[model samples]
Target: MNSQTELAALLCSRLCHDMLSPVGALSNGLELLADEDDPEMRKRCIELLEQSAAISTNKLKFFRLAFGAAGGFGDNVPVEEAQEVINALAAGNSRIELNWAVEEQSLPKPAVKVLLNLAQIGIDALVRGGTLDIGAEKRDGNVEIVTRARGGKIAFDETIGKALQGEIAPVEITSRTAAAHMIALLADEMGGGLQYALSDDALVLGAVLPQPEGMIG
Candidate 1:
């Protein structure tokens, strides 16, 4: 299959796989709630339904921005909105903490996209649960995005690392690394670049994109 078609399929596969778990839980919880006769079991089913719904919703929001068309007419998205999505994703794991360091109240669409995906990479890298710190800044007509994950026994998939650097063969790309491939493509298309360093206890990914002329900080 052609790379484009393969990439599209992989992205779809990834989204469907992510949505299936919570969506399935929501369905199962509803089924249990319907049959349960005891008060405590019914209450527990309700709680499970609530949690499943939240998870599904959060994944939707996160994917909307990262993979789908999400922003309005403007080419910029509010930093707070972006941060909220990240926080929601992080909240799902109590062992992981998020530190958002972007000072800008608003950011260009590309910047936000880069920020979100890079942050996700950091989150995934922390296998043992860790702190994910995301930062973005604009200066001298450019944007700098960075995500760092630190924890005990951290490990990152090397395939993802190569994909993020645009070093992976198209034939080797899969659903798991499609986002990284896209990120690398965007960076190269913008005349910017992606950099990363992975270690046993830490992982860092960053990108630099040149802002449009007259773009505000």
Candidate 2:
């Protein structure tokens, strides 16, 4: 197979590997909760169950928009949906602030995936308390998505940036870097480009994607 196809398959496998643990834990917790008899234990189990369910659902939704096909139900996906996806990824712990310039524009699936993946990377970079700003603007028939994470200390392993730039070796691209590389490839496929910059207290990622021809309003 060609290099692009191989990279895509590798990325898909990496995503599945990362998601399997949490999803498996969720299933196991549910099974255990169904058999528990003690009220207090059952209550705790229920809490765990709820938390796990939320994680699974939110992660799946975010990944669907980021790494998989999005805008599944309709011709256009609302901006609100993208906002919801980000909030879900944050999961109440990470305080993410979103600023969207194109409220009425419907992004193509590839653009949405690249944006979501970049957001995920930004979230990961801001482990400590921080603010993540996401913006999307359309100019000259091209869509630009920008994500910036500013906080106490933005810490991201170097490998992720390497993967985003398509410079990392395939075997060295772990689950952490898989999403970034996938997003970068998606941007390239859409006739766009990805860029990343890191400052002392902030990390910024940007993607510029060309809009598809003959797209209706």
Candidate 3:
């Protein structure tokens, strides 16, 4: 298979693998709650069950839009939906603040995936509590998505950056690195490129994706 097709399959598998644990835990929690005799324990289990279910559902929805093919979506997805997806992913994670600056433009599926992956990377970079600024702008006939993670001692791991450059060997495409590499590959496929820089307790990931003819309308 071609590289893009291979990458698509790999990404799908990676997403499923990443989600399985939380979803399974949610299922188990429900079962435990159903079987528990103690009212207090059952109540606590129910709460856990609810939280787990919500996390699984939200992550699944966000992944569908971000990595998988968003069902019934037109050539360009609505900006509101994208924002909602990000918000869902960020639920209960107050350490990272998401700031969106996207125009009311519909982005192609690939472009959306690239943006989401970059957002995920930015979120990961801010392990020590920080602000994640996500913005999209149209410039010179291309759509550019920029993600900045600001925090104390921010560092972008070298392995991830290398994977983003398409130098990741198959064996090195572990779950930890797959998302970032996928974003870079998507940017390359769109006839654009990715740029990354580290500045003053912040790491920035920027990708420019080519806009298809008549896609915005």
Candidate 4:
């Protein structure tokens, strides 16, 4: 399969995998509520349905910005929007603490994608729930993004690392590596590269994208 087609399939697969749990919960809750006669149990079912719907909505918002073309015709996205989606995603897991250090009012679409994707990866790495530190800035005519996951236990995926560095063959890319692969492609196209450092307690991902002329004020 061609790289673009494969990438699309992989991303779709990843989205499906993420959405199944919450969507399924919603369905199950509806089923139970339909057959229940107890008011208390019906209330509990409705509450679960609400939670599942919220989770599904949050995921959709995050994927829309991170993986899909959002912001309409604008070439830049407000940093505050990115922060909101990331915060919503992290809210699902209360144990994760997010630190936003991005001072730029907005970032190029490509840079925003990298920032959001890296933040997602960082959140995943914090298996035991810890701090997710995200920062982005403009320096030396380039947009720099850094995301760090710090926890007592870090689940570092070697395949993802390889994907970020363009070490994986196109035919081998899977749903798990699709985001990283896209990030690598974006960095390369923008005259930059992806970097990462992995240890027992932390996983740090960084990217630098050359800012387009007239993009900065």
In terms of lDDT, the best-performing candidate is 4
Tens-place lDDT per residue, model 1, 38-145, is 999999999999999999999999989987779645878899988988899888899998888888878878778888899888887777798998999987778999
> What is the TM-score of candidate 4?
0.97
| Residue 105 miss distance in model 3 (angstroms) | 3.7
Candidate 4's residue-wise lDDT over 65-122, tens digit each? 9989895357999999999999999998999999999888899999999999999999
TM-score of 1: 0.95
Off by over 4 Å in 2: 1-5, 31-35, 73-76, 92-102, 169-171
Off by over 4 Å in 1: 1-3, 214-217
TM-score of each: 0.95, 0.84, 0.86, 0.97
In lDDT terms, how accurate is model 1? 0.86
Q: Which predicted model would earn the best TM-score?
A: 4
Candidate 3 lDDT, 127-207, residue by residue in tens: 777888989877777888888889986767767877777776777776677777777777887788887787769888888
Name the candidate, 1 or 3, with the larger TM-score value.
Answer: 1
- State the lDDT at 134 in candidate 2: 85
Candidate 2: residue pairs that collide: none
Once superposed on the true structure, which residue ranges of model 4 sit more than 4 Å away at CA? none
Per-residue lDDT value at 28 in model 4: 93
CA lDDT, every prediction?
Answer: 0.86, 0.76, 0.78, 0.91
